[model samples]
Target: MSDIFRYIQKYQNRSLKELPFTHVDALIFAQLSYIDYRTIRNIYAKPKLKQIAHLLDLQEVEAGYLSGKDNRRLLLALAHAKRYQNIQLINETKIINEETCEQFHALTFAYKQMYYIVFEGTDTSILGWKEDLHMLVYPVVPAQQDGVRYLEQMLKHPFKKAIVVGHSKGGSIATYASLHVNKKVQRKIKAIYNFDGPALQSVESLEPIQNRYYKFVTQATFFGLFFENEENYRIVKSNERWLLQHNLYTWMIEDTNFIYLDQLDSRFYQINRKARDALLSLTHQERETFIVSLSEIFDDNQITDVAQLTNSWSQTSIMLLRSLTKVEKEKRDAIMKTVGLVVSEMLRR
Candidate 1:
């Protein structure tokens, strides 16, 4: 199965006017938000796609600082590809609130008659991951607040319509921003594309823009099923398994569209539901304590990335055990039991 790179090569010569923007195009831009665009050009000023290509060609040291593995190289190629070069970057902002452990990036682009707002997903930082967990108990996150402000600012510009798009945590923010924007701005929205992003903890605030939402997740989805999803969602086939399927690069594309699946894998759904239920079973204070403890453990070990935290399994296991000793027995037991259930379910699969 093909991915976005192959899709670009196949349709690189076609313009958005000729083919029109599709969900696949949204996914490409959503993933592109992960690139460190600030290093290439001033994000405050409009920069042509070719200008970004030039920076990448020069191997600018900061071009792809947050991009993993070959993603930077691929994004560089995409910038130069005929299909994307005509797209003009309007604005991009990356904000990190250390106190709240929130990290967000909003990128606005002008393509043809439409304006696209893309939100960046979690990077390698432990703080980023902590914020993702914080979503479990909080209805609104700092990043979501930034998203609303970004969208409201962008809507002030002259444009026919807007499309909000994001992958992973960015997807959640995109949906939140669309829902919270003023009704006048809401009327101007074309659609919201959430690719493998978590659902909102509460949909009560989403009524105004409910119909405009479109969610896409892989058959083995985990993050996408995190909360409640009242809006329509599609299940797509993936070339990866389990959590790795969360990566947009692993999502399958055929020609110009995704390889849609009729339903999500049963095991994935079972695990997701049980995980959500288990978390919800805890009190707000309990959840907060658990998340704080987990964060502290990572800090104690000086682990800033998930890979580093997981790589030294023996060390991590020892650290976790020691951390648990410091917590109240009731909270510790609840955390352990929930973890046991989740692990058992995964092992069964």
Candidate 2:
């Protein structure tokens, strides 16, 4: 919990909001900070609804609402969509059709672009509650279905080569899409970079498509590198401490853009297999209960409430470390850990 406060204060200029932080607020704020600023502006400025939809592949809303919300949800939605653009070209081409050439040229001019998209919910709401709810609707299902849908629809550009990348759940979708796109599309992809997204539920279903994915995780990252079947992708070591392991930090920059730790080997994929087996042993009901419990913490008055609720790693961690001695460990930990963090940070402020 203290880690969250330290991050907020250390990056105050990067902080999007000034009020006291809550559990959800901390998470959303960290996410926004990780993103690059120009990408955020492009999401809002892009006039085409389909273009906006393609830019934000995670959340699904009808194209008609592109101009309606003028709020953070729409803004965050756009920000998420823009993270996947990694198109690169060696030679300038006027040979392609004008529209296609224009699209290719747009991404070719940049090695990597940073974006910051934020959605500050109404005071009555916590940060990212609506967005997180949307992600959970298909809990326990393989993400490839949606992943393929997103890739096919959004990544229609034809260029010499491109690298697609993302963090957390974004990584999951990127891996799924690259492995499953048609062979022609697959060849166009030079590489894929995923930062500690969770593994798939059924490896047998994914065996055919696993070779193309490149995954990175810290030694201590609890969620992405582990869970479901352990990640079977290339895993990278990070210099940051365990608590700051997720994508908000750790990924370094090379030639101005982010540099993914370049290590993918046979051992990494094997670990992902082990992780999958361990996660499958848990019952389906057990998983649903866990999400429900995490959601309850967000039902708090603001996103930062979790910081004030407890002084520990998280409800999920307490359950695992304590051997789940009690049935209610997850819920109790969520409330307590959140409260502890938020209160301490408020006092410090």
Candidate 3:
């Protein structure tokens, strides 16, 4: 299965004007926003992609190390590539809140006289995951609010056209920002690419610019199908299994485009629909209480990332079971049922 890494190798010599920017490029920029720009703070401010790549190379050589699995490496390679070398990064911002469980990052780039606003997805922090849960009931999350402000600020700069793109939670914010921006800003937006991002709880405000939205999801997408999405979406092929398909890196690409699927697998579609219905069945207060309780339980175990919890599955499972015993009976049952359905669906797959 060919991924963005291969896409870069294939089209590295071609500029955006030569081959045109596709969804694959959007995903790359979205993922690139995850890199800790603080490391290369000096040049990273309004630096060209080539300059960012140079800084990354220096960091690798100085440390005498590089992780092949690192997204930064992929981004650096893309930066050095002829296709993206001239892309100019204008601004970047990150806001993190542990108490509110909010994490947001946005990067503005200039390519071929147009602007691209990319949002970073969920990170390893527990707060980042909680923000995803907050979407279940909240009409607009803190991160989404930040995204809108960031876009508005970016529009203050000189630009002829604009595009918004993101993956996972970031994708949700990208859609939110594009829809909520003022009419003057909206006039400049050419497109909004959402890579496996959850849908908004309410999209009435988005109706005006609905035609500008493009959604892409995978076969076994769980997060992408979380809420109501009235717009049509392209289901793309993925190399990973089940929920791992949510990883943008796992999505397959051909040349400059994604390997699009006509539709999701039947079983996976049924499962996703069932999961969405079940989640919507819960009241807002119930969903909030459940997420808070679940987050507290994870905090009690000092588990910051999903990998950490999985690494000590036996211990974490025991801890989770014990913690559930203390919850109020009504809330506990709802939480347990939702969890059981997810586990059963995974096992069935």
- Highest TM-score, which number? 1
Candidate ranking (TM-score, best to worst): 1, 3, 2
What digit string (tens of lDDT, one per residue) describes model 2 on residues 202-231? Answer: 344554444545555655554575544544
Expressed as tens digits, the lDDT of each residue in 1-349 for candidate 1 is: 6987888888988878788888889988887787777765543377777566665444543444454554655656667777788687878898988789998988988876788889999988888989998998788999998998888888876656899999999999999889888877888888999998988887665667768788998997888887765547899888877777888888899988999999789876876776677667767876777678878888776788877865655565566556566556765565566556555554455
RMSD in angstroms, candidate 2?
Answer: 14.4
What TM-score would you give candidate 2 relative to the actual structure? 0.45
Clash total of candidate 2: 44
Model 3: lDDT equals: 0.77
Better candidate number, 1 or 2, judged by lDDT = 1
